[model samples]
Target chain A: MKGRILEVARRIFGQYGFHGTTTRMIAQEVGIDISTLYYHWGEKGDLYEAVVLDIYEDLREQLFEVEKRIHGLPLDKRMEIAVEMMTDYLFERPEISNLTLFRYFAKTRHASPLDFRVPEIMGNIAHSMGLVSDKKQLPPDAKMKMLAVMNAIHNFVSGQNFFLTMLDMDEKEYVKGVKETLKFLIIPAFVHNGATTKRA
Target chain B: MKGRILEVARRIFGQYGFHGTTTRMIAQEVGIDISTLYYHWGEKGDLYEAVVLDIYEDLREQLFEVEKRIHGLPLDKRMEIAVEMMTDYLFERPEISNLTLFRYFAKTRHASPLDFRVPEIMGNIAHSMGLVSDKKQLPPDAKMKMLAVMNAIHNFVSGQNFFLTMLDMDEKEYVKGVKETLKFLIIPAFVHNGATTKRA
Candidate 1:
């Protein structure tokens, strides 16, 4: 029961955001009374925090997996795999990008102390792309470059409703186009700039 | 008074969006009563529509300027000019990207039957980039490619609030990084793909 509520909360919150969602709506969706919701989650703020933390933790795990899978790979290959895996993961659950972007731009009065852990995950990505030697001391330009890459991916996933219509393709084709475009745009820049080029 | 209200409406709407904003708040910020707001702008929906059209017109004008400036230039030079101009325009008034992304993802119950005029603009960009011969019938790949570039620009501008913090830089540096990163990532793909290589 508790897990069900959290799942629904994630979806609802991802769609509507903290400013747009309410405990009442979550309860109605879950077929539970407000009291039951309160009993399990305590308050709307707590529930929102839980949802954010849940998303952050999931992103961390996915990044870790990508890091491991791309371990010891060339720069181009690592970016190819990283972009594909991350885009697929986020597209499958677009609510993740929805929520991630919401948190990125929205200045809610109820802003939480938590973030998506952008700096930490950014370092991980920088490390994966061979853009930096140490994750802790990520260069400002590296962070900015990573932001450009990460921002494009998040926008592509979240703005699908708009882009999908503009292109007039089905979701599969849309996803394929996105993966191809990302790979095309990112690979040459990163691989060409680094001395440790794609010898693979 | 009316123009002031519209300006405030643009900013507020860009920040909070149509769903998150209210006439009461707008009126309060404008130092006018709700009645005056309605008198000038009709219902909230009418005002919101006005805001959308206003932005669309501004974008059309700016795009026209970019197109005229880049005419007959080589691919790389045209791309450089376009990215710098568009990024600067959007960054100056980030509410544009803010409201845009909000409309993209927010499934607001009051979603207006209007959009940011995406297909039309995509065609304009494609034609300028030499990706499509005719603007009226853009290829799917062309539209998709254009979306990737536009999405990156919008994301960098809109997500600047989050990104600026992560990079620990002021807005000027952040904007420069975004433009450089954009040029670095995009120029290679489009120019290399096309037969009209940069001889300049």
Candidate 2:
């Protein structure tokens, strides 16, 4: 029952948006009574939070595992893993990708706007940056530069229009382009700086 | 009267979204009859299109003027103009900015999506790349790389979440960061490759 509710909720919410979606509609889609929904999730707001949180937790698990694998990889390799991990994670659940990053962020009146926390996502970024910082490879300024580049790529993939348009690239080609971006455009500036700033 | 209608339309459509907004509400807000609105703009869809198109045209003009002023300037100077142009264009009418980029982009059942038909936006990007292509003196592949970097910056600025959270930096500082990112991360790669190819 819980899984059914979630499946229906994801589809409806993705199609109609959070504001347009109503609990009754979700209940109807789930083929359950309204009382049953309240009994399970307490209320509509609670249900919405749960649905959003589930995606975050799933994303968190994936990101954490990637972080673990690259625990002590060098700076460039770590960045490459980070980019690939983010792209793969987002692609796995495009609906969740759209909901979390695009739909909610685009809205003027977001539910629980003040408390819309994604600490796990931030943790992954900070962890990635830590790997670079610990390498003592880049200059002091390179950490922020690396973070900015990663953010730009993440934002691009999270965008629906851009991601859809990029369907031209096969998975291998896509990953290749991503690595090429990180390699040629991103890595060198920090690499040289890292060598010089080893002490600092 | 037309200007008054547009002002009310911007606010109303923003809150209710394009599909949710109506000619009646616009007319009521402007103290005019529904018939008066149709007399002026023919239909609700026509009026909505006009509202969004006007904003797009305004932005195009603002970008064009900035590009003209920055002609033959250094890469950094041209970047500064691009940032200033985006800041001024969005800040002058943040409502229109949100409506055009965010609200209109949202897929709705009944509403036609915003089609910003102005070709100059792409032209400006191509021309900017042309200038940087000379500076970098790279082959065609490097030029494509330069375009991607600029596109990433464009997406970053136009993105709603980035704008909302970036309150720490004033427009000028934020623009400076973009310029620096372009200069350090992007221009250098192109220049490096271009130099390599030239030597080869």
Show the lowest summed lDDT stretch of 10 residues, model 2 chain A.
Answer: A132-141
lDDT of 2 by residue, B1-200 (tens): 88889878877765455555667878999999999888887878778777777766776677567667778776545655655555555644655545543432245556575555433444554455334334323333343354356444544454434533433455665555555654666555445543454335
Cα TM-score per model = 0.93, 0.70
Could you list the CA RMSD of all candidates, in the order they appear?
A: 2.7, 5.6
Candidate 1, residues B1-200, lDDT tens digits: the string is: 99999999999988876767888989999999999999998989889888878877787788878888888887789888999999999998888888778877876655568755777887788766656667898778767778788778888888898887878889888888899888878887777654343222
DockQ of each: 0.65, 0.25
Please report the candidate that would top DockQ against the real structure.
Answer: 1
| Candidate 1 residue runs with Cα over 4 Å from true position | A195-200, B194-200
